[model samples]
Target: MPASAPAQPIKLVIWDLDDTFWRGTLSEGSVEALAENLQLVRDTAARGLVHTIVSKNDFAPAEARLRELGIWELFVFARISWQPKGPIIKELLSQMQLRAANALFLDDNPANRAEAQFYNPELRVADPTELPQLVPLLRASGQPDPTLARLAQYKLLERQQQARTQYDDNLAFLRDAQVQVEFREGPAAVLPDLGRLEELINRSNQLNFTKRRVTLPELEASLRDPTRRWGTVRVHDRFGDYGLVGIYCLNEAENRLEQLVFSCRILHLGIEQFTYAHLGFPVLAVQGDVATELNQTEKPDWITVQAASAATETPAVVATPTGQQLRVLLKGGCDLGQLTPFLQAFDLDVAEEFNFNNEHQIPVHLEHTLLLRATREWPAAEQQRLAAALPFLGREAFDTRLWEPGYDVLVYSPLMDYTQPLYCERATGRRVPFGAYQDITAEPPAALAARYAQRRFQGMSEGFLQRFAREFEHEGPISPAEFQQNLQWLRAQVPAHVPIFLLSGAEIDVPGSGETGARQRHELMNQALAEFVASAENCFLLDVRAFVQTPADVTNNLRHYHRRHYRALAQQLAQAIGAWQGQGLGHSPWADLKARAVGLLPAKLRGLLGR
Candidate 1:
């Protein structure tokens, strides 16, 4: 038995007839068609290429010449128009359901080639004379070319177009097309080519959601996530199988859709709607500059919309006072210090004089210690030492006493306190270990009243317990349920006008030499902490975990950030504070004037005038 001819992968081969496919323009004079050029079209078409013609000529004259050469039917599409060649080529490629990136556009006129390349830069443009050279290059791509499937699909579209009574009624045609879609869920095993999903997601533009391009390892990790669902969509019709054309990864826990992408080759085929429908098509909330196919092409009715009751509620805006320095009290381990420069830039003062009166720095580990000492749970020597150091307020000191540390804002974090042990180094380079307090039992709510009592003895003044507390609870490695209850009590102690900004922590850990059990605890605590912050009614939570990538971005030790990390931290803090303030941090009178001046003009007039 004789071997069948191998299918050519190149989908379409477009030819320009005037002085390109033939010796001269048919309209100007009698043009002689080159035998080799004619054979090139015939051979390419026979090898499963959809040969097409685009030329500047009278349609009748061009068709007559093609008919004389007995090759008119070989061309699936022919455009003899006075309009620009670029747009016509785009239409032809779209009609054929082929990507411009894969098709070859051959024209002798440099101007025509430039026009086509301009419209779709991905198109492979070459002079007809380069046919001998281009054939080998096409073969080198090594794709198994399916013969004439594109042409048959194009013919079906053309028949549908002819049958339509009205123009531009694509919805009617799409409905009548009898499109069949097979939606597959879970893992790369469902895909015919595993890497194809990655390629489609990375390459697709108009259909992308997050526009996140991932490596194979990342894709594998996503598939492995218990909360994530992976989907692959293969579309076909009575006309042909379009192959696996769409892929998406959905995070069920966050209700976030990531990297939803489809091949533009199947742009108008309703594959996108079919795929999203399988996953219960989510209501898209536009973020940034996402240019989806729905934004470009006509909108379809088949989109899966989330339930009405599931919609996110808008947060109530808090009113902030204008024109006063934002007095911020720093708490938390060490990262709180990183916010100093950014805070100062925004007229947020953190100096001792600006701090609430009677506020004294206490070691984080000693927080539990102070609880013991104030409750008289400390040993005799320790109790006496603490009593002498802070005599004004203790169990025996005073009735109805308050720890006054006056500040408009408080920033605190228990991240380092929960994650690591505390210690003080001596001048001789000897290290003194402060106990981790992992064994310390949770104290009663009534026991923490004197947390700041040591400072009250120094004759400082102001709200000892009523100042607004601001905390960056960036991920802590420990989950203390009592800590959450403490936040509610703290909010209750502060004035109603005071804001409790709880900035959430980032994912700061990298894989290291640690017990597997410890790692598991850290992950659980991080997740629980996020949920806790989000649920706080009186707290303004700034989830900074979105900013942390690899542990190196925020910190070297995964707990404390380097000074270099301050730039990003500052910017995030600035945005968060701006929102909390109801305006920008550095909003001066001059900047306001400039903004007002710009806002006065009509949008078009402003654009014309320039900024």
Candidate 2:
């Protein structure tokens, strides 16, 4: 096979690590890290292009090396091993749900590239020497995706694929997936996504049934035309949300489909056939070589139409008095501070109560259930004495807006309980949750102080570290039983009428993250949290595991997620809140869009803009 220009835009870039992604072979010696390749991966990834490895190397060493280089998390569905490159690349593309024609394979060896092309005839092949010419084109390929939402979606697909392999029966996997589709009809619903509609109509091929392309002006006109019933299809499953995957234009006047197209991302999900059946199996003039054959009688039993929530469909019955905003106090780790703006987009007045640096220059986290209990139960003298004794806990740490009656609703995350280790005061036998995984008292004071210093943490001086070690006994993270007990106590503390929504942790393994067994820890905590929510009144669980399934879904650790996921989380939180209130919360699409755009800005710029 000879190399030719891709028929479609390159959506994926497959890299051969040795002498290609980096300078030298890993099996032989330390490879010189390629600065250009590193930056290219970052730049191209931000623009929605997916990258993966198809190198013929040992998996462990190659993974460790990639981790050392700080680019291990960027790639998904990595196929690194001493395997034939040709067959591996072909299978890799299949698993990634990508077409070979829309993928570029880069290898330094001409023979490797030739072999890959032989297996995948349409795959674009390039030598490392061509990167100087190819970098610009690759960078310009995808639309601006500052949050790497596209990358996240593909990661979701990768997870789904991996899980699918576990089941020998495909139908069983689909059934277990719990696939759901939501259809949006009418001009008001479909017009806002005019750009996406146009793109799918023109760019999609494998599932483009009518093959009727339209310009933006024509699309806008057709959407308004009463004769055409246009609808957009959104799909989600146990895996994650696949937003607006398919579009259909039904000619009601003739009972024929003018347009029925879907992104290949939803291929094999039976969405096309599902959508056709949902639309009463409209007469469709079949286009050339569609991946799926549509039939009139069979609708996929695996996929069910997700019913629009009563709150979302109708004006929300305000929980407070008329014209008053619902006061929501969000309490959690500082990372959850990202959800405030998105939550505020709904008809709610949001107040944040996150951990902050105290007078002793140490960060104090107060969201722990025990701390919440101490705020009211502990005597003033005792509180002051402990506040003075422990640098990690300040006088203000015991104070929280949670006890204040000013707020009507509470959005709380008990992640600190899930991640932090507890230390007991030898004198009082009172336990206080602090750092994660490590016992502070067990570490040498000098080493601990130096580690804290590197993080620019103050007040963890050698003197304080020594004093702390002498006085406090290390107790590991809270057990699931104790966690449930605390949850019960907290519920009793808050008023019965007030709704408490808890944000659960992501139970995904983050590779290269030093936090060992974090996913297992989260799974344990999440189960306890779910059990508590099931029995507790007015308590809800904003489950993140549905969307945050892979290592790539999180950053650095399991507790923190990519910025875009925060928006999805906020949306989930709002819906749960609305359902509790017995009405849908009002939303500002403009505000949501603005937040998304702001999320794309550089961190410094976002900070300067006060986002």
Candidate 3:
């Protein structure tokens, strides 16, 4: 028994001109082409097949006829000449870097088809009438075809190529194109587009990291699996939008890159670098053929890794109808409390400390309650000390109801000094002057004068190092490692999208004396605060000291802002909101262009250009 013909993958299909491509010949007969055949070429190409013409006629008139039919550009690598069909098809295939076995040749004349097959035996020869039936059979592989979309992508790519000649450097051409890339992950990903992903994976010869193929059903199963994380990317620029051009999958637990594939149309853009950087993952160094080639090229310096911190000092944001409503959780120093009204004036939702007096100071009982909840384990003596101080402390734990989650911004300036047992005047019931607190006795504070004597020591005044070690079961002062863990815990309590605005404490003054020690301590605190902000993601430093370098007319206090500075604070808040709004979907280049163009047109013309 003879073996059946092998099922081959068709990369390119060349059409004959005289009688196969259309109803008539170009030179003698009318230049009429069948609209159905033209659509068939477009539809077939859209399925990821490259279509071109192999005509035996004068090049110009034949090209002009195809142009008149509005389908000239659809044909890539067209060869219109009097040369023998076999040699022409062979050259075109060689230039495209495709194999003869992966190509199909269609002609009306049996001699032309026989000659083509004789030269390249693996090439499949078919009658023009057979294409309508043959094309469907060829697409049995079920691979995703992006050829339809490639038409637009290639057009943009051609324009980019042409623009490259105008610039001396490639970076200049890319920058001039004004490309914007947006990455999406989690529930927003297009994992349901399984066929597209499968095609993307198989069609990719150079950049397919894993080179593994999964069917549509298997892909759908992966999307449903909670253990796997997936993401898709969309690219847009001045010329056009390349919708959903890239897809990636990662192991949720291991954070390992499973598959990475992008359309070759965007290879020049250095998308791989941007993708890895934005996702905060290093390149996997997978050993695919294309990956090997990519590794040899010079590393791209033009692509910027997405900023880890959410805050942009001056973002180019467009204005929106409604302003951003942030839930500003004031959890820091008294300065943040004073800034509440100013924040509210800018239409922000302010949630100040709960169960506090007008001064924004936590009473001793409330402090004890907070410490009790925050305390994991403490020495018996330390626990007793807290118990003894309880009667003198206020009853309310800063209202628990006020500690709601999902706050848009957290104003965190935790009172490091106030937490010390000896320095806590609110618990001891004596208002020792602010600068005198460092002088507390060997024992906890009993009177204001004892605080002054305690200041005689050269080290930290409250012996906080010893007390904190015993209470928290830790070995030292708040180390950076501890601060980082605390920050992570705080992040876990809120939504991932919430940004923390850390409020740094104000510079300390001795009131009556210019004590260098007090300035040193304050400077140390500021330095530590800056480092803390740098270590954490989505946390921005809002230096309260920046707004209070000089006292305002309404108040001489250094810790909090005066009413006179509210306008300046409001302006800063407005700019932050505006910057966020500007990054929204409304900021698309197309939208901006339309708005500008419509603005220049007259009312009558605008009516004609109505939405």
Clashes of each: 11, 1, 10
Regions of model 2 farther than 4 Å from truth? 1-7, 310-611
What C-alpha lDDT does candidate 2 achieve relative to the native structure?
A: 0.82
* Candidate 1 structure quality by residue, lDDT tens digits, 32-83: 9799888766555533467788888889978988899998877766788888
User: How accurate locally, in lDDT, is each candidate?
Assistant: 0.52, 0.82, 0.54
**What is the overall TM-score of model 2 with all chains considered together?**
0.53
Following a full C-alpha superposition, what root-mean-square deviation does model 3 have from the true structure?
Answer: 26.7
Question: Which candidate tops lDDT?
Answer: 2
Superior by lDDT: candidate 2 or candidate 3: 2
Q: Per-residue lDDT for 306-337 in model 3, tens only? A: 32122122122222246546566766444444
Better candidate by TM-score, 2 or 3: 2
Candidate 1 matches the true fold with a TM-score of 0.37
Q: Would you estimate the TM-scores of all the predictions? A: 0.37, 0.53, 0.41
TM-score of 3: 0.41
Stretches of candidate 1 off by over 4 Å are 1-13, 23-51, 56-75, 81-105, 109-142, 146-168, 187-189, 193-198, 215-227, 237-241, 281-611
